[model samples]
Target: MRHHIVHAGWLTAALAVLGGVFALYVHPDFLVTLVDQIWSCF
Candidate 1:
């Protein structure tokens, strides 16, 4: 039972982080800037 709780907590945190990142991509301006920065690395 304790192990299951710990796993759930980690899963929830991962999902939250992914949700936040997805929210950021919803903006065209942010997406463009992110792509520009990544492309610059090459």
Candidate 2:
């Protein structure tokens, strides 16, 4: 169970970083707001 949880956390972090990179490439201006929204989820 604990291993699964850690795996999920790492997966989520990786996806978030990918998302940030994509956002930066497509919409640099909104990256901050996009990240702010992501942080709000936490």
Candidate 3:
């Protein structure tokens, strides 16, 4: 039971992170800035 609870907690955190990333991609301004920053690194 304890193990299952820990697993569920990790899964919830992972989903939250993935959802946040998806939200970022959906925003065009963030996408453009991210690309610009990566290009600058090169």
Candidate 4:
């Protein structure tokens, strides 16, 4: 159980960093457009 908790925490931290980097490097408009495209397809 402890191992699982640690793993989840690390994964969450890594994803947060990845999201920050993506937001900083990519344009917000592009991300919004991609999300819109995917959502419309669904």
Candidate 5:
């Protein structure tokens, strides 16, 4: 049980990273806009 839970956690994190990479590849400008908005908030 614990082993499966650990594997699931890693899998989730890996998926999240892959999703982010896909987003970056598909929308490089999105991160730039996001950072601009975040900096404006400060």
Candidate 6:
């Protein structure tokens, strides 16, 4: 259980940093356009 909890903590921290970087480097409009392109065939 302790090991699982420690792994979860590290996972959360990694996700937080990934999210911060994405927020800084990615534009919402670009993401929106990408999603639109992916769904256009549907």
Can you give the TM-score per candidate against the true fold?
0.64, 0.63, 0.67, 0.60, 0.66, 0.60
Q: Candidate 3: lDDT over CA atoms?
A: 0.95
lDDT of candidates 1 onward, in order: 0.93, 0.90, 0.95, 0.89, 0.94, 0.88
Q: Give the TM-score comparing model 5 with the true structure, all chains together.
A: 0.66
**Candidate 6 off by > 4 Å:** 27-42
Question: Model 6 RMSD to the real structure?
Answer: 4.3
For model 1, residues 1-42, the per-residue Cα lDDT tens digits are 999999999999999999988888787798889899999999
Sort order, lDDT high to low: 3, 5, 1, 2, 4, 6
lDDT of 6 by residue, 1-42 (tens): 999999999999999999976985667787778789999979
Looking at candidate 3, what is the lDDT of residue 26? 87
Q: Locate the minimum summed-lDDT window of 10 residues in model 2.
A: 23-32
Per-prediction backbone clash count: 0, 0, 0, 0, 0, 0
By TM-score, the better pick of 5 and 6 is 5
Clash pairs for candidate 5: none
lDDT of 5 by residue, 1-42 (tens): 999999999999999999989988799799899889999998
Best by TM-score: 3
Model 4 C-alpha lDDT per residue in residues 1-42, reported as the tens digit of each score: 999999999999999999987885678787778789999998
Which wins on lDDT, candidate 5 or candidate 6? 5
Better of 4 and 6 by lDDT: 4
Query: How far does residue 29 in candidate 4 sit from its true spot (Å)?
Result: 13
Q: Answer with 1 or 4, whichever has the higher lDDT.
A: 1
1-42, model 3: which lDDT tens digit per residue? 999999999999999999999999789799899899999999
